[model samples]
Target: MIPHAALQTAADRFGTPLYVYDASELDAALGRVRSAFGGAQVYYAMKANPNLTLLRRMHAAGVGFECVSGGEIARAEEVGASGDRVLVNGPAKLPGEYAAGARLGATFVVDREEEVGLLPPGSRALVRVNPALAVSTHDHLATGAAGSKFGVTPAQAPGVLRALRDAGHTALGLHVHIGSAIRDAADFSAAFARLAELHPAVSDLDVLDVGGGWGVGADLPGIAREARAAASVFGAELWVEPGRYLVAQAGTLLTRVVGQKRTGRPFLLTDAGMTELLRPMLYGAEHPVTALWEGEPAGTWDVAGPACESGDLLARDVLLPAPVPGGLLAIGEAGAYGASMSSTYLTRPRPAEALWEGGEWRPIRRRETPQDVWAMEQGLE
Candidate 1:
């Protein structure tokens, strides 16, 4: 749902290879999740973007914050997030991260025994269970598989839950993030179904966190059914931590087609590459690539960026109209991991981020200058 006019305005003002986010689209997605999950407790995963403006909007919308690091916790605090509404979660948590969360009274989603040791003596916490169940999505996003580093085993979780209780920690509930980019509701159903079976083991549970991995046009009805079922069995509330599902469709990566030529086959090189968005090469992720300008006759083209790596491609075998040297390409569904996963590789400065709010384009993060990239080196000299 990238508005062409708004995107065009953003491009003209902020230049090419910019990140544009629609606040209305993001709010609509949050509304859908709230309605679809029957008003489940939603914790916006800040690791997805961590834009302070967006975080403030989410906080004002009554959504909690799920942080993975001390920096994220500070972001939540800066955005006025409630301590009780914050969750600290990750596989490898530093002592500082736990201390920061503990200072705010944020709950910890403990993934391991060492993580459990990070929490306070009588703090409320949830144990993440690695059900070893794979979702029907990309392998890289699957977190519930046997060798996954996401959570503790289902059998081992109960013992840990008891140990936490014995050590005077209040075991709030259980968490299972199967993976991201989940397309079907049955995949979620199966995981929660398994967790439902394991509910008897996790004693004194108050919440059932069937973590979020919803894809574009995911099955909300089926997910609600399974989530309701799991909650019914445990007699607890359902909580979800949706990252991509709530943000992906609301974002568009506006990149200018630098040059178009046929080297055996037509290759459309763009200004944006792995440095701006790494999904295509990193996870084989696909998104709708549309021409923001006029169209001509249709032809097959391979879309690549200016990255040094050969795998820096946004799409391949795509049929698009004639492309000029200065044409713009709108990469859809880039709201979630797009900017967050970006790196300053090849000494390229990261792209700027803008939010479409109040029917106006507001620049959230400014584009980095060349000096910003090599400033560390300058100090050494």
Candidate 2:
């Protein structure tokens, strides 16, 4: 657990609507993953939280990265994570993106038949298969289900692999990501079981890339055990790319209460809004919101952000102390998608990011100024 004092200090120095990541917490999560999956390749999906501070630390710890876009790949490379330490996995990679991966000697998780054209001849790659497995997660997050736009179907794998071979690429593995925020061990275990069943048919199946979708407080031990057993059966190299699991619990979003209202139920508005953290509005994500001081539950309050939309609520019917303006509140479990998915919607400037390392707060991503936000549109009018 992060010292609340550290969070207070960060807000005191940086200001509200700030993100503070605990480096020690992140390291501990990575350590646990390493110990659990011995000899298996663990890739940090940089999409969750691409802060350079965190990326550099993971690189130093010898953790590989899985990039969904060219930008993420660049972020990983910027932190000195190179070939074999990086894998590019995107269905719609840009023209030179695969070339960039090739230059970095990064493995590609080919999602489409045409994407194979981007890789050079004889380069080893993994083909992502869509098993149409209906995972017990949000419909929007279930990627492996049929009709999703993520990967090729199992039926198409042989053809895709043949195309890759025809184009002189080596199909070394098969990958599957049923969905995100999946808590049931059975979902992961089943996905692995399905892949294990498909292994013998794949002539060059030397690796299995079971994508990560573990939720907070998920069944990790059971999932690991299942993964090990499945890997043992195929004797294939195991790879799990987890983004949220490693960082979600390590961050807190500090926002200051700017306004308070009472209409039967309490309404507390903060400077942070959907533009800063869209998970609530975007995915109905729930994070425990707590006031800085300890207090008894006053009543169920509506916590909303400063966004113009009525949907910009951080949470609803949440128990908190009496609504008070000019007070501070920290949203927990915000270490993953909070900052990474942030946008300058409504022209709001992006928040500053800080990392708590060695018991001190250090600025990682500086807050954007109005000029910084308008720089791109300068001279247009």
Candidate 3:
């Protein structure tokens, strides 16, 4: 674990509503993936945390990138990820985005048949097959099962492959992303078996992309083991696009206590809230939070942000060391989807981002200012 003293210094210098990432922690996570997979290609799903600094660091470490939109593709390219090393996947692709990926020579474009023709000729493509297997996770995240909007059904794969083959599009891979935050190895193993069943029909295949949705929590080792074992079964040029598992535990959201209140339950109002981190309010997600300073014994407090909605609570009835006004609190497991999903809701400016390396903190992204928000609006004549 990184020392709290360094984090305190980072918060003090960069100010609250800041995101601090430990470079060493990220390296350790990548090293773990490299060691476990043994020559398999790993792609960092850019949608998880596309902070340019993080993306560039991943590229520098020899990791590939996975893009879901044209903007993400441009971001990856701006950060030095060449098109040949980028994989584009999304159920819906706008004409402009498709053209951008094709123009960039993206390594693999995972298609769901709805817009396969949108891709330019000679584009290497992969068919996203929906296993239709129900994996236990939040409904908003469960995409592999039947009726999901993510991929084509299993029965539709062979036909899609035949069409692509006849159309002369290079069908070189098969891709499937079951869901996010999965906890069981059996889920991945089963999904792989389902994909392996279709491998024989698709010819000239050189890659298999098991879309990254590996879950991370306190039980990371078990999850890694399961993911690796499942990947071994493919026995092809395997690729895993892991986002959450890579950086989720390497970050924290430091919020300052703004006030304390009691309603049906005690509420600890913090300077940081849904506007800064929305997982809890959006998906009922739970993040382990603790006081920054060592102090009085723990007590149950409903952590909430300044949003007007009643659902803006971060964690309810969570135990934390006694907090006072201006006390800092750290929200754990925030490295992946935390800041990437922040918004300017309630007209609040976005937070800045910093990277911790070599025993020092450096500002990677500057904090947003009020003018930055309205810069896009046309001024009155």
Candidate 4:
């Protein structure tokens, strides 16, 4: 977690609606993953927070990347990641994505059976399996659940692996990613058990990737135990892909209280909105908000954003002190999808980002201007 004083300082220097990440927190999260799953290859899911500076830091620490798109693969390449260090993943991969992965010699996670034929010749791949287990996450986040469009069924996984080998591609192993932000460890154990049942039928696999969706406070060791057991059944190496787990707590969104309004319940208006952090409106994600300035207990208020939409609330019924116009408010657990998912909707300039390292604040991304937002529409020569 970023220090409250540090968050305030960042807000004062970078202006309101800023993103600040703690480098120490990032390192600590990586350390925890390494400690928990000894000898298991770890890939940082670039979709979480694809900041180039953060990517370089992870690469320097000897971590690989799990890329989902051509753009993400380019980001990984920019940070000196390629070949086995880059794992390409997606259900519907574009030709450009396949070209990018092939050019970099990256391993691809084959989502569908047809994707095996789409890859470059002799490409190394892993067959993603949908365990069809009902997970305890939002419907939008469950990728491996029944009826999800992410991966093939368990009945189809073995055939997909064989299809890859028959197509002259290197069949690495099987991959299973249940969902994101899954709080139940039992969900993972059950998924692993399902895979373990495949046994000698799916033997001789080189890798067993138990995709990462562990909640922030999840029991990693317990999950790793189950993962190791499952991998042992195939005598395959273990691999894990963690995105939100590594960065969720390291980030803070600093927004200012614009004013107060009353529409049924009291509301604290903010300069930031859905354009800055869409998780609240998109997934009903509740980020913990902390008031920076000191004040007396006022009442419970809905922290509303500048957007005109009524669903633009970042948080609701938040117990906060009296409204201090122009005061700073820090939204916590934003290090994962906050900045990466930000858009220029409603013509709102996306927030700038900074990193706290070596007792100093380092600016990572510049705040966009109105001109920057509509530059593409200016004119085409």
- Best of the candidates, lDDT: 4
- The residue-by-residue lDDT of candidate 4 on 1-381, one tens digit each, is 667788888888999799999999999999888898999999999999999999999999999999999899999999999888999999889999999999999999998888888999999999898999899998899987897998888888889988899999999999999999998999999999989888788897999999899989999989989999999999999999999999999998999999998878888999998999999999999899999989877799999998889899999999988889999988999999999999998888899999999888999999999999999988776
Q: Write the per-residue lDDT of candidate 2 for residues 1-381, one digit (tens) a residue.
A: 778877888888999899988888898888777777777788998999998888988888888999988888788778888778898987788867777787788888999887777776667788998888888888888888887899887878878888887888877778888888889888887777776776666746678788888888787878888887776776778898989989998999999989988776677999998988899888888989988866778888888899879899888888887766777889999999999999988788899999888878789999998889889998988
Clashing pairs in 2: 122-168
Global lDDT of each candidate:
0.86, 0.85, 0.80, 0.92
TM-score of each: 0.96, 0.96, 0.94, 0.98
User: Can you tell me which runs of candidate 2 are displaced by over 4 Å?
Assistant: none
Misplaced by over 4 Å in model 3 are 217-235
What does the lDDT come to for candidate 1? 0.86
Candidate 1 per-residue lDDT over residues 7-124, each given as its tens digit? 8889989997999998889999998998888878999888788889888888888999999988999999898885778999999888888778888889899898666666776888
Shift of residue 155 alpha carbon in model 1, Å: 0.8
Ranking by lDDT: 4, 1, 2, 3
Q: Which portions of model 1 show Cα errors greater than 4 Å?
A: none
lDDT (C-alpha) at residue 131 in model 1 = 82
Considering TM-score, which of the candidate structures 1 and 3 is the better prediction for this target? Answer: 1
Which is the winner by lDDT between candidate 2 and candidate 3? 2
lDDT of 3 by residue, 309-353 (tens): 898887888777777788888888889889999998877999988
In candidate 3 the C-alpha lDDT for residue 187 amounts to: 79
Best by TM-score: 4
